[model samples]
Target: MSEALASLLTALADDELILGHRHSEWTGFAPHIEEDVAFSSIAQDEIGHAAALYSLLAQRSGGDADGLALGRDAAAYRHAVLCERPNRDWAYTLARHWVYDTADAIRLEALHDTADEDLRALVTKMSREERYHLIHADAWIERVAAGPVEGRMKLEDGLKEAFEEALGLFEPIEHEEKAVHEGYLPLPSSELARRFRELAANKLDELGVQTEIYSRSDEAAEFVASSSGDLIASGDEHAESQPERARGLGGRSGHHSDEFQDLWDVMTSTYRNNPGATW
Candidate 1:
């Protein structure tokens, strides 16, 4: 595979691997037995998908799938920051789930047209399983939206909290232009991001939630997270009072938050401890 294609595959696999771990965190702690089983199953599926992608990469790049999945340093991971964030609450978890899975669906749809037959086939298989995930997330979204006022409020709050980081899911990867030129990626991340915003806006409108979450100002590109975690536009006078935003920045370039380090240590400890061991 070309370096660009390898980078793209690594990014895709890393997203699934990290988010799979997050989903697994809920295995025994979900609100109900059904949810516990549901999340566990989803986690399994995600990890399996990651494994499949890594296997393809390994075949093309002459690397080990296990090494690709578990042996990478934290700074080498290309997943969106959204995938690495702690699941703060069920509402947030569901919100992130909806955002990530919906975006994944869009991504896979675009990948379905790729010139690479192996990747296209894999995407087709993954999309079949992903359809159920979408159904699960959409059902919960609708349930929370139609439930009590408190539930609706929490759901909305969670969506607002996750919205921007979700946008980072489409942050352009390194050499993405080459990937597009090679037909490895049929659509650029920006176009995919636009489609996601439109789809999300329609869904939120249908749910009676505010569509303002999808609105982005030109200054949004200038906004960066401060040391204190608040987002401030460069040279803006009221930087101190600006709300926290853009936690999803720089993930495509492998810059991650402190939370990722903590998660990474726990996640890689096993592999690091038994470097050559096989399961």
Candidate 2:
């Protein structure tokens, strides 16, 4: 169970870590400068959250957190598919931001009740910070979905398209059940996906965006590979193939998007060359 708890923590942290990298890509590319500042803060928040979670996992794994985060091969990461998908547009990004924050909030709430006192306390701290993220995302979802012209349609479409991938956010990594058995993390792995989807449906409806919500098995197969342009392209294939290995052809299984490798190269370039030097 301790090992399972560690894997579960690593999986959750990796999603935040990769998605934070994706969010950082918009540092100067957002439609509005003020929004750029606001979104950038969120990116930093996610990265910080990832760092804190990774620190705990590193302690458990008996390795350095930096290596755990940046040195691992793509196939070793256990982030959800939604986090790795490129932020093609502001609307799509916000759709994911809104949904993921809500889902994360609920998950953290469950974690706050764990029998492991330290883990419960850490999750409690995270839940406090997550309130701000939820506010920002909810405001954007409501305003965009309720106002404007073409933007509303685009936001709606983005929500619908990403809903399934968002559901994939709750997918379990290796040994999640052990965490439950040991009470290191509350909430049964089997029911977490369903509860996450239900919360999403309620939030989307309240924000005036309607979409279907679904679930996948914790051990469902990997995403199908695209033979054409990027799988993120509008017409690209989404749910087709299934790989036998956990680190298969998709983002969740540790296989990352092309963007992930590129991002990691840049993120670590400076740190790797100047190791042991003060920043």
Candidate 3:
């Protein structure tokens, strides 16, 4: 019922929905049959995860899951820019998936100690599925990197292109501090971002890929590290200051692209005409 909890739920659910939609776009057009089947399954998994998160949010906020998912305006959705962006090429999807899923693994890990017992249990189950998601992403990443020059080049280009969007995955909203204070989340968004970068870098290194150096703002990094440390060490209300340097395309701030608006219209076409419509 708190702003922090709502933001977390909405953002997580939105990311899943958007990524699922993107993956679903490839259902009939994958590079091959096996990939098509695998991507379809992953798409289903992402949408199912979104449903689960939405259900938990509904329980906490006394809202209907269908309405929460199908009724939101484009500007109200809180997914990362990476998830909402078009799958420009297969390399882009692979890069985005690897980056997003790795960050997601870290994000979910930070929620293991959620104060809500039901949510904590849900996180446990969700983590199981997330592991496979990470595995799938990593496998493709490795395959492409270790394959032909064109494959490696494509993956590299995609990774560089999506780096900024990937950073958006951990952009903190105003109530993130409250979430940490209340034990709804164990780690602040800042720490999660650091862990994401580190983990992604490690994976790329293992695959023999040279990563582009991401520039960091000294002031922003200091504030995040300092504030994050204090919040973890002591439970208290902190300022609403967010990691602006990490913001990409303003997804977490409720701004979206035309691509997302189009996505929303298509996703909600049936429901818009009839709220009682069922899939």
Candidate 4:
């Protein structure tokens, strides 16, 4: 209920929402049809997670869930920069998938024990879905890391590039201190960034892949800036001042890059023409 906790919730929800949108772009377009189905499920789960968290946030923000989602200006979104980065290829996307889900597991595990009953409950439920995402990413990481020369090369290349971007997954929630103080979220005292990287490295090592990780203090900040540029510039609100106090990237805070305007136009085209119409 505190401002701090509410901010953290907004950050968490926005990240999931934007990332879900990025993932949806690959639907029916992935390399294999079966993989398409699998990827679609992950994308849907992310959106579902975002919606659930948004429902929680809406309770505090005093707005309907849909409004929290579709009505917000881009600057209001608090998702990390990595979530907005373009999905370059299947390998890169999968690399991102593996790293993100692993980091999320670490985060959710800590949250599941929070004193806030509602938050704890949401984390508990999301934990189940996260398990599937981890499995999906892990399976593909191994798959691409094996068998042929081309596959291995793609996996290695993708992991190399994505590993740096994946560090963005640790982008700090602005109200972290308050969230912890209020018992709304409980991240472990142990170094989560370190643990997450170690886990990811181990997974890659098992698959005969070697990844180079940058210093978190530097990489996370960089990812946020670059990814936000891609998301906001690709749309219409590219000229807004950066959302300095909002925390995280452009769209989540309302200062979206121009690209989001374009995306918003398409995403809301149908709804705009017929406000109350149903499919």
Best of the two (3, 4) by lDDT:
3
Best by lDDT: 1
Worst window of 10 by summed lDDT in candidate 2: 228-237
Q: Give the least accurate 10-residue stretch of model 3, judged by summed lDDT.
A: 229-238
Better of 2 and 3 by TM-score: 3
Better-scoring candidate (TM-score), 1 or 4:
1
True lDDT of residue 202, candidate 3: 76
Per-residue lDDT of model 4, residues 144-223, tens digit only: 77868897888777666666555445544555556677776666323566677667767766776654533322333322
Model 4: per-residue Cα lDDT at residue 133: 95
True-vs-predicted CA distance for residue 7, candidate 4, Å:
1.3
TM-score to native of every candidate shown? 0.90, 0.81, 0.87, 0.79
Candidate 1: tens digits of C-alpha lDDT, residues 253-276: 787999999999998889989978
Clashes of 1: 0
Q: Report per-prediction Cα RMSD to one decimal.
A: 4.3, 6.0, 5.5, 6.4
TM-score for candidate 3, residues paired by index? 0.87
Separate clash counts for every candidate:
0, 0, 0, 23
In candidate 2, residue 77 scores what lDDT? 82
- List candidate 2 stretches off by more than 4 Å: 212-252, 271-279
lDDT of 4 at 144: 70
Error of 3 at 34 (Å): 0.6
